[model samples]
Target: MRLAFNNFISIYQGLSREIWVLSVVSLINRIGAMVIPFLSIYLADAKGFTLAEIGWVMSSFGVGSLIGSWLGGKLTDKFGFYPIIIFSLFTSGIGLILLKELDTFYEICGGFFLVTLFTDILRPPIFVAIRQYSSEKNRTKSITLIRLAINLGFSAGPATGGLLIATWGYTSLFWVDGVSCILALLIFVLAIQPKKKIVEENDDSLEENKKSQSPYRDFPYLLFILSMVFFGVIFMQYFSTVPLFYKEVHELNEAVIGLLLSSNGFVIFLLEMPLIHWVEKQKKYSTMQIMMSSIVLVLLSYILLIVGHDLWVLFIGMMLLTLGEMLMFPLSNAEAMSRASGKYQGDYMALYTIAFSISHLVGHNLGMQSVNIFGYNYTWTFMIAGLLLCIVLLQLFQFSKKREELSQTAK
Candidate 1:
């Protein structure tokens, strides 16, 4: 146990102080990420909306996210990450606080859209910041550390949000979430100053050549992005429709549901860094192979739900899903970062984030509507089919990347 603990501690040794500070900021911000997880439930219980209606409102959040991510990426490239990150944090906090005031269906939709717009604008800049702060060798580990912090906060947030909902009601969640964002903003501003300019190690000609190539023109990367869209769609079901399944099918309550969801975060927090470190040390499996295996785990997770209705099934399924998440996210992030070139890092990261935004736009509505119309088992089956497709895409991307590498070698 001591040996294992020391090994675990070793993975964190080389990360820069700025990366740690960013992780801390993410922790603070995500700790208040209480609203979105329970938003569907709140809509159903408090607003008396139909599942279909709730899906639409949730999709509005996706729409806003899509726009915000695109805008943020462009703005980050033009204005730099510092100003964009600060602006997003401050505006998003105010939006979240104001979100609690809306009661009507349309009002709620617009509110969610506006709030998520500002919130998601934070993604590309943050990704760029991570790249700037980390060395290539430690980049994936750094990303995992940040994810660990986010998951830790998520674990605390939902568990606390559940209690808050039980006592003070859902309104309390919004206030807490909003306040946390502002607090995170203050911490970020006080701790980290802006860099004057990004310094790249690539020669001018190579850098210029890379800067001229748009991500949209990269076929293999596009396939990878599409796979992420499918992955996001599959993973996002847990946030939107899965809770409803627990409530209606398993007959679980708000607090219990919160605990179950929080368990994903907790599991990731405990295991991700070590697991990532171990994975990095292994030369036997390629990153794509690891990602494919992770997808299989997620696929099996849904299959478990299809086969069993027991509470234990939920826990086991969550464990599988969390394991898959731990494997998939950091590696995928590294892949995206690797693809990014000089002057276009924001563009690359934006497209990567946009995949999830598209998933948000499409996934929640699809999950909820499928559940409303076809029932939970069918929804799970549908998601399994989607994962299968995603796996195929990843394989194709891997093949294409290998072919490209071989061609370059021959040259």
Candidate 2:
């Protein structure tokens, strides 16, 4: 037990003070992430919207997210991290408040779009800050710590949202979620030091800068983005399609659905850090190798849900899904960071954020349509097959990289 405890402690040994502060910020923000989790259920159960309507409303969030991520990346590069993070949080809070009063289809869609835009705009800047604040050695661990805080907050959010929804109705979620963002902004202001804006560039230097920072210029990184989109679409189903499935098929209430959602967080909190530490100790797998294997677990998770109708199967699937997330997310983040230097970290990470945001844009709308038109089994099967294709791509990427290295050596 002592040995195991020490091993666990080792995972956190060298992360910077700033990283912990950022993690705290993330924790606060995510704790109030009640609205998105329950949005579909609210629209369906409370407002009597059809599945197609719910899907489109959710996709509006993704559309906003897509624009926000792109703009936030460019803005963060031109300005710095602090202002963007602060503004994103504060405005997102206001957006959430505004969302509560929006009941009609168009009204809610527009409101939700603004809410998601402001919220997601923060992602790239936070990642840029993470890279700035951490050492290369602890980069992956830093991302994991932030995600750990997120999952910890996620564990609390749904559990609390469930109770609030049960007792107070859906609007309570918006209020709490809004308050959480404001709280996170306050914590961030107090904890972190001000970062100076990047030095202004001359016209020639600006042109050079644009060329260097453009994500389109990097082929391999673009390939990485493609893989992430697939992974994200599959993973994000937990938010969109999965909850609706539980509620519709099983006739579970908000509280139970929340518990089921919280299970993902519980699994991550208990096992992710310790497992990552152990894997690092083994030193047998590359980041890509770990991530690729993790995708397979994601496939298995969907398979479990498709094959089994028992509640226990839901728990089992969530465990597998969370485990895959634990492996893939942090490693993939580290991989993204590895591809960039300090000069264009914001742009690179922004591109990375786009993949995640776009997945939601595509996933929610597409997954919902699939579930509504086809059955749940068909949706899961399609996702499973998509993951399989991702695995093959990852393998091919690794193989090509190896061949390129050999060719360089021969020269």
Candidate 3:
């Protein structure tokens, strides 16, 4: 027990004050993340939108997210991380507040798009800030710290949002979400410096960094980003398909589905840090290896679902899925950072963030389309094929990254 406690503490030690502040900001924003999770239901029940309308509204959010990430990356590169992040937070807060007044389908859709745009615009800057704040050794740990805060808030958000909706109604959710974003902005303004200046290295390093800035020029990194998109697509099924599966197959109610889904966040909050620390402490497994293991776990989780229809089986599958998420995301962030030069970190992270955005658009369609056309049993089988392809892509990415590093060093 003493050894275990020390190990957990070790994971958090030596992180910079800036990273801690960012994590706090993340926690604050996510705690009031009452809008998005319940947005579909709110539109359907409160606003009287048809299923097709809800889908269009949600797709608009995803499209806005993709553009927001790209725009944020460029802005962060030119103006630095602080301004873009602050602007995004403030924009999202104001947008969400305005969203409550919009009743028409088009108005609501536009409002939601703007809200998601700003919210996603905040992401790449956070990654850029993490790279700026942490040393090489603590890179993965820092990203994991932010993720820890996110999961912590995710675990709490829906439960509190549910209560707020019950007591004060859906508009309260938007108000609270907006207020939380502004509160996060206040924390940022008070605690963090307004600008992050890029530290200069030697001329050769500067040239290399500049060259790496354009992601389109880096073929290997592009392939790696593709792998990330695939990973994200498969992982997103947990959100898109798993709930529907539980409903249709097991006849689980909303309460049960919510409980089952929330467990993913709870388990990550409880165990992710310790698990990450333990993995990093081990010298044998590389970041790629850890990622591959995560992929395998996700694959197995889906396989579990394919075999069993019981609630316990669903719980087990979700547990595996949670563990896979904890292992994959921070490690992938670290890998992406490692491959990027300092000047291009924002662009690299932006492209990485876009993969998730793409998955948000694709995962649901993949799940629903497959299930509709082929049935649930075959849908899981199709996902297994996708996971296998991701494994191959990850392996190739690792090889390509190593080769690029060797070529750079030989110069």
Candidate 4:
């Protein structure tokens, strides 16, 4: 127990200022920004819309998120991080307020698109900017804290939103979320100043003033983006498809569904850091490799849900799924940050976020349609198989083909 306590203490000591600020921002964003804007409940309870209409509304959010993620990266590059972050938070607050007043479907859709756009737009900039304060030596720990903070916020935020909706109604949730976002903006405005690149004694003079290149011109960043698509599909399902699965098949009550969702956070808070050390310990057990393996496992949760329809079993399955997700967040983040060019860190991270956002926006319904049209079993089987195939490809694909081509030419 003492040894374990000491290990955790040392880990905490290693955390950088950037990671700390990110965690605080993430905590506020999750808790405050989601307090209102209940898509399904509002559509059903307030508007008397059908399940299909709600799906469309949710899709609007996805569409907005995809565009926002791409734009956030570019905006960060053009305007710099602090300005873009502040501007997006303010813009998103307006979008939330629009949700409070808008009633008609078209108007609501417009608000949804804008709100989704600005809300998700803030994410990649937050992620990329954190890298300025960290190096390769500590990047994994930095990402781990960021993920933990996000989950921490989610753990508290939705419950608060639920309570606000219960007592005051849906609009209250929006106000709280918006206010929370503003609070994060204030904190960021006060504390974080951008780092300076001061010249060092041993640094090369020729390289000092060299023109900065964007990650779009960097091939390795692009390659990592391609690898992320498979992983994104697995992550997108939780927000997009899993709810329908639980409703249609598991027949879980609202409380159980809440537990299942929160369990994802619980798993990460409990397991991810411990597992981080194990993954880092072996040369072959890279953070990326572990993340790839975990994503395949996450896909398998759908399989068990489809096969058995048992609540306890599904809960256990999701624990495993969360375990997989826990791996991806830190591992892939570290991998991407390492690969980015210094001049284009914001743009690169934003582009990376775009891949995740597009997968959610474009692919969420596609995957959900599987469970809706085909039986649950078929859907789970197909998605899980696809994820496993991705894991295999990620492991074998990175550098082998390029080296093989060169060797063939030499022969």
Candidate 5:
């Protein structure tokens, strides 16, 4: 036991300081942001908003994300990841704090929009650093750890919020989010004081480090971004539609609902690192196909949830969602980074993050309008159609595998 423990410590010790810093930075950043899952409930229960108003308010963050993603990616390409991350974290803190004070619907929604925008705007830069800090040896592993931290934060944040809001009220929830974010920002500034600025490193002809010389040279990277964003609508449904279903069908209370929804995170925390490491050790192309397959399976689970709302059925569906997420996040990230030049790791990662960011916006905007017109059950139908559409896109991309292989010479 001690020998295994010591070896694990040794492996961790050998990771680059930048890698560790980025990992911890991701962990802290996610922990700070995790307070949001219950924001809809908080507004509905404590703020006295109607369902229609709450739906629009629920989407403020997505609206901000839509505007931020492309701009944020461009900023990372122009200035650097460090500046963007530091600025976004602090702004997220301020936004959360202000969310506590707003009373009117417009004021609250407007504040939430900026909060979501500023907070998520940092995603491109954060992901840029993550891909930058990986090696072939640990590329997928490192990102998986980062994803694990996110899920871990997800596991705790809303469950904790449920308890806190149940006793202390909702404004206090944003205050807690604000304080934690401020602390995260402080940690990022202190722990990751980058010794030098971001410039295209001259030396990276390494196996996984071939990078784009300029953002304009990133067309394939941009294609991968389109693929990622296309599927994001399916993923976003877990946050928006699934929660609504739990409330409407199960009639579950805040804490119980939080616990059920959070079980996915629990599954992720226990199993993801080993699973990612194992999957990446396989042939890379096949590995991604498997990950993509998992996503299809996850989408199918939503179909199941849409059909059945019983507790056990929901448990099975949630389990599928968690497992599929454990595979999807890291592998997709690594694959996206793999296609780019060494110098444009940040640029490539930013595009990938842009896909996710835009998905939130597109999904929610569609979701809000769809719910008003067709009702909530068909929201899952839209999600299913989006997932199936992406599956078709995957098929289209798979046929180009030979082209991808032929282009590997570019590295």
Candidate 6:
């Protein structure tokens, strides 16, 4: 136990103060992130929307996210990350607060789109910030640290949000979520001093320019992004269809569902860093290899659901899914950062963020519709198939990357 504690401490030793502050800001913002997890349920239970209508509403949120990601990337590159971050936090907060007032389906759709537009704008800039703030040696660990904070908040948020919904009503979730975003904005502005400009090393600039002359032109990177979209589509069901599955198939209530969701966050909070640390220490697995393995775990997770109906089966499935998430996300972030040109970091990160945005636009709607039309078993089977396709894409990417590396070495 003493040795285990020391190892845990060691992984966190060298991250920057800025990284820590960013993690805190993420934690604050995400702690209030109660609404999105339960949005489908809220729409159905509160507004009397059918599954199809809820899918459309969620799709609208995705549409906003897709546009916001593109806009945020462009804006971050032009104006820098600081102002964009501030704008996103403030505007998204206000949007969330105002969101509670809308009643009609169209109004809620429009409102959610606008709010998510601003909310998602926060992603690219934050990735840029993480790149700027961290050293290469500790970059992945830094990303993990930020994820740790987010997961920690998720651990608390859903559980609390469930209680709030049970006792006070769904409207309370919006107020809390909006207030948290603003509070995170305050903390960020006060704690993080503006970053000073650094003169780029010639090698760094040359390498960045070579790799990212144009992200649009990079075939391999684009392929990698496609794989990420698949991953996101499969992974995001936990937030969308999985809850409804619990409620509909298992007859679980709001509080119980929240606790189950929170379990993902709690498991990640406790185990992800150590797992990451161990993986990094091995120094043998490439990023793509790790991602492929993670996808397999996620695939297995869905398979468990297809095979069983008990509460224990659900818990085990959640555990497998959470483990896959822990392995996939931080490494994916690092891979994206590595591919980004220092000169156009925002643009690159934005593209990366957009992959998930695309998933959001497609994943939630697809998951819900699949569940509604085909039922849970078919839906889970479809997700498993998606994961299999993702693995193939990753393998292709690995081969392409290896060929490129060998060619570069020969030169």
lDDT value, candidate 4, whole model: 0.73
Of the candidates numbered 1 and 3, which has the greater TM-score value?
3
Which parts of model 5 have CA positions greater than 4 angstroms off?
1-14, 41-50, 166-168, 195-223, 243-259, 299-314, 340-347, 364-385, 398-401, 404-411
Model 1 poorest 10 in a row by lDDT: 201-210
Tens digit of per-residue lDDT, candidate 5, span 120-217: 77877877776566566787777777777777776667667778768987767778888877887787788876546443434434334344355455
Which candidate number would show the highest lDDT if scored against the true structure? Answer: 1
Task: Give the clash count for each candidate.
Answer: 0, 0, 0, 4, 6, 0
Q: Which ten residues in a row have the lowest lDDT in candidate 3?
A: 198-207
Model 1 C-alpha lDDT per residue in residues 22-67, reported as the tens digit of each score: 9999998988888977988999999999988997887787789899
Candidate 2 local lDDT, 1-411, one digit each (tens): 999788768778888888999999999898899776788899999888999999788778778989889878877877778899999999999888778888899988898888888898899899988878877767788888899998888778877999999999888888889998999999899989875643322334333443465666755567788889988988889888989988888788998897888777777888887777666666677778889889988898899888878888888888888888899998888888666544566788889889988886788778989998998989999999999988876777667556645654565
**Highest TM-score model number:** 3
Residue-level lDDT of model 3, residues 186-278, one tens digit each, is 999899985446653334753465445687677778888998898888888888887899998889999999899889887888888778878
Query: RMSD to the native, candidate 4?
Result: 4.1
CA lDDT, candidate 6, residue 148: 93
Task: State the displacement of the C-alpha of residue 329, model 6, in Å, after optimal TM-score superposition.
Answer: 1.0
Q: Sort by lDDT, best first.
A: 1, 6, 3, 2, 4, 5
TM-score of every candidate relative to the true structure: 0.87, 0.83, 0.94, 0.86, 0.80, 0.87
Assess candidate 2 and give its TM-score to the true structure.
0.83
- Global Cα RMSD, each model: 3.1, 4.6, 2.1, 4.1, 4.2, 3.1
lDDT scores for all predictions?
Answer: 0.89, 0.83, 0.86, 0.73, 0.71, 0.87
Off by over 4 Å in 6: 1-3, 37-55, 101-105, 162-172, 198-206, 242-260, 308-314, 371-378, 407-411
Residue range with the least summed lDDT across 10 consecutive positions in model 2: 198-207
Model 4, 1-411: lDDT tens digits are: 999899866665676776798789888888785633366887889888888877777788778988888888877766667788898888887667667888877887778888888988887677766666665666787778778888788777767877888899887877887888888888888888865551222223222321265667655456667667766876677765776778766677878887788778787887787777556666966565576677767876766766755778888778777887777778877777655544565777877787787677666767867867886678667777768766665666556435544654565
